[model samples]
Each structure stands twice: as C-alpha cells, then as structure tokens.
Target: MMKATPESMTDADGLEMDRCFSTRGGVAYVGLRDRWPWYTKRRSASWPFAELRVADDKIVISSMFGKYAVTRDDVASISRFGRIPALYDGFKFVIRGDYEAVVFWALWGPPVRAAFVRHGWEIVG
Candidate 1:
C-alpha cells in the first residue's frame, strides 16, 4: 500500500495528491513533487524507496539497494499483477542487463506509458 507523510496531503477531490501527482522523472513534472513514496517489505524491515530521473542520455533508477541506468537500448517489459483479486492492480517491469533491476508501481497505465515513452525506452510487453 502507498503511505504518505504527515497524513493530510489529499487533494480537494479526496484523492491522494502525494501518490497520484508526484513525478520522480520526466521533463514536465507537476503536482506535489516533493515527497518520494517509501516501500517496506513488512512492518519491520528497512524501507526501499526508488526514484526515476532522466539523465542526459539515460533514465536512472536510484534506490536503497543501488542505482541502475536504463538506456535507449534497454528493453522494458511490463506485467500486471495484484495480491487482491481486483482491488490492488499494479505494474511491474524488468530491465534486462548485467545490472538488471525490477520496478513495481501502483500507478495507472497512461502515466506508466508516458514515462517509458518520454525516456525513449522500448516497451516489449
């Protein structure tokens, strides 16, 4: 699940502004782009947070573990999955390389598509 800091950052429509609007990468970033969402394994383990940033010629994924760069040559394959039957659908991707990294997000399709397109990554799935 997505958690927010200070717990009162929703928009007027009661939507989560922090989660829905924050952009870690791309050219035209808008909304509450201040906070990065934190991902935890359980309730006790250390949180692993990731941010996508567009470098001069590559897209970078920086996280608690390490950093990975996705170039134009890298292939991005996407898959949809969820723990619940239909309530928590999310997307996951694997970038193939020696330093391959998998990223998951609860974001909808369009934004995810736009991110890949903007970075010139080839979407294979």
Candidate 2:
C-alpha cells in the first residue's frame, strides 16, 4: 500500500494542494473530493472529505476517522446514485465482503467513474 505524502498529493487539476487531509474536531478525511458546499450545509457535520486513490488492483480511501482499501475482487458493483445535473450526482461502491458501501458525491461523477473503469472495475449502474 502506498501512502500519500505532501510532495505526492495532487488535486484533480494535477496541481499539488499541499494538504492531503481534512480534519475536524480531531478527525481527518481523505477522498476523491470533499463534500459539496450545499451538501455540507444540509448535513450539519463538517467532516466528510474523502481522498480516493486507485492502486494496482484496489481502491483506497484514506480519512482521519478511518481508512479502507477495496480490491477489484472485493467489489460487487459500482452504480450512479442519481441522474446527472442533479444537486449532486454521486457514485456508489458496493463491496462483496462485510464492508459497507461507499458513496462519493459531486456535481460531476465522470472523472472518478472513468478512473474506476480504467482499472477494470465493474459498474452495474
């Protein structure tokens, strides 16, 4: 497993954001992208940032609260949560084991969706 360091972390634009994690009340979060502004306001919680990275054969999410990595073999399906252009079009990642599903929210889901597809992961929805 490769860990993200300040010199290695980059944003969607390929530029270094310097900060690799988001923290609130002592907990940190890392994912593809943090929650949308509207979603964050509605949720009433500050910490939902997720840092998603695709490894050799797995998807890794690192967060201050918890970290999990799901390999291609453990993935059951990847589906779209809602129609495009909605408030937030999110993607759902369902794992085959006892792990719970993970959903990533954003106005645009194609970028990350493409990343998963490129890794030969299955998309059921």
Q: Give residue 13's error in model 2 in angstroms.
A: 22
> Could you tell me every candidate's TM-score relative to the true structure?
0.41, 0.53
lDDT digits (tens) for residues 1-125 of candidate 2: 98988777775534345522222211122222343531111121122455566544656555544555567677776677545573455556666754345555644456656766666666666
Q: Tens digit of lDDT per residue, candidate 1, span 26-96?
A: 11111222247322232111112555443224545455555555555664554443323323223344455
Stretches of candidate 2 exceeding 4 Å from the true structure: 1-48, 83-87
Q: Which ten residues in a row have the lowest lDDT in candidate 2?
A: 38-47
After superposition, candidate 1 runs with Cα above 4 Å error: 1-48, 73-100
| Candidate 1 residue-wise lDDT at 41 | 30
In model 2, what lDDT does residue 104 have?
A: 52
